[model samples]
Target: MYISLNEILKNSIFKSVTILAGEAGLNRKVKRISVFDCPCNKDILNRNTLINGDLFITCLEQFQDNKDGIYDYINALIMTKSSGLLIVTDDCIDTITKDIIKICDESDFPLILIKEDVPYAVIMDTVNQYIAIENLNAINTLKLDKIMYGSVSNNEKMEILYSINPNIGQYLRTIYVDGGFDSAIEELKTHILYLNSRDDIFVRSNNYYIFILSADDIKYLKHHSDATALKVKEFINNPKVGYSRIYSRKDISKALEEGKRSLETAKTMNMSFQEYNPLSVMQLLVSVKDTQEAHDFYEAYVNAIRDNVSAENLKEILLTMEIYVANSGDYKATGKIMNQHENTIRYRVNKVKGALNMETDNIKFNETIAIAVKLRILMNEIFY
Candidate 1:
């Protein structure tokens, strides 16, 4: 029996009661004891620290003092993996003791209160009986820690949706469209719409128009691309289940850039009409998937490229590009931000293209990759 008596006066009242209890064959089975909330004494350590059947006692005065020592004793019990009883009693239950009680509540530490007329022998017998029965309500709760660990699986996807607003992350609607790839696009739209018709999802696809109930649904659909591709290659899956070879985040980011560019160009032309911008799409994206998709994409992409690319190299380009793109290729400001000669920055840009294996001096490709990098950071916020 490894019992800890954390009483302020364990020396006087506590020890006398314990000795009497032991004489009455109450603590006869006791192996170790801990004395908490007592004044420190090095002599006490040498005399009372038991090795085997000898009674071992540790005195901890303050809550912080008890923490490490108590944790060690608990961990020792856990390591041994034994069915043991831990008893904690104090003369005055202060904030520290209250906190200790909270820990006990959370941890399922077997607790017994010392009350008037409750003989120590009876208490000891009761504890022995409880131990024999192996009361494990706390152990059951401990098992829940494992169950609560890690990320949610595909089965949990719908759990998240319904956990929020039942109708929020999904929608059901129909629309018409007229434009290029009309028939193929219509089929794709119809397919998405049909998929969304289920309670799990919602879709609206027609001609040049496309709409989805939830961003999560779109992400899920996009993830299915790899699965769809595998199924098609192995089983000759039909167009109804065709998979696009597009990474969802990449495609979304590109579309966002296109939208922003369109809006900016519209502004240049003094046009009232405009499409969505990257920032607007970002807002919409957050509203739907709430960053989960972005995080997943970032983690995957970063892990994929980290082996080949140095973070420093990417950072350098990003820093220089900030000024260059801001000033619309103005060398002076770009160089100033980089703290390098304008020519040096140009040289570095050329070097970046070489490193990335970009041909024909395609700055658009560089820009695309830059956007991808930024998207990675955005995705990390959602995923990992």
Candidate 2:
């Protein structure tokens, strides 16, 4: 139960602070606590509350922002060889308290919320007794939001995590590496850097280091598993040293050859169509071996539906359908988004069915067509 002393003080009043400090006082043998001041001047009076404790209580809250400062404090705690709290106090609830709750839920920090009415004697006694209780802690979904909002942007993290977990990509900011970086292939590890489009590299922390590399680059690193991550981190951290060649010399040539082959494969697989939006369809068709047949089937499907389908009308229908699927077929919400009565949407959808030669009422069929339409738009853009 490693806790930040600052978090405990930030959320409660002077009375609660006294209770917390008193309980901590009972454990004089445990002298690793580090105390920091809240940015607010009002909370400075509580500094004596933590005096003569494990570590001195001053200038600890260096991060100005509540979330940033709290995270900084947490990182400092992890850096230290102690198992105690860091006390920080502010007059009211704010980012510090929010972040503290976040960290408490994310990792084990044993957060004990103190109300002003609770006497210090009762509170400390209760906390000491209740502290032994394990597994009563709650895991809220808010942790994910906290991680995103409190921590650094997810761009670099997403790029690296996507290699191991692709499903998290859409929910995160992506990191992209320039294809032109191939010229410095040998220094790949040493000079390996991933940045958002704006070009800020992610700094690694105890929990994570995020880097975005192309699929081809990720594969290359996987091939040279021995020194991939370490080399990449070194390169990103010290790009000026130009260690790019040192770590990547052994596999640069091989990686370059593989990268070229991958590019060619991707190019060959790209599908295009001009008459209709077929982007999503193009992705599906790329995997299909019989491209000519796929093109013919798509053309036929479009021709049959074109006369009845105006671009705007089809867009509305498709957008509604996508929303429906995204909402798991919430008819009321989907209808509202379509700007048509639910029954009218049902009717238009029925008409779409007659044109597509499928059962409109069938959930599976409608879902499939909706997906296909999305694909068609993407494919058309690619081809055009």
Best by TM-score: 2
Q: How much is the lDDT of residue 57 in candidate 2? A: 36
Instruction: Score candidate 1 by lDDT.
Output: 0.37
Judged by lDDT, which candidate is best?
A: 2
Q: Write the per-residue lDDT of candidate 2 for residues 177-223, one digit (tens) a residue.
A: 11222222222222223222222223222222223232234344334
lDDT of all predictions, in order shown?
Answer: 0.37, 0.38
How many clashes in candidate 1? 7
lDDT per residue, candidate 1, 192-275, as tens digits? 443445332221222122222223455565444234323322322121221112223213223323433443333333443333
For each candidate, how many residue pairs have backbone atoms clashing (under 3 Å)? 7, 25
Instruction: Determine the C-alpha RMSD for candidate 1 after optimal superposition of all C-alphas.
Output: 21.8
* Candidate 2 global TM-score: 0.28
TM-score of each candidate? 0.24, 0.28
Error of 1 at 368 (Å): 1.1
Residue 179, model 1: lDDT of: 23
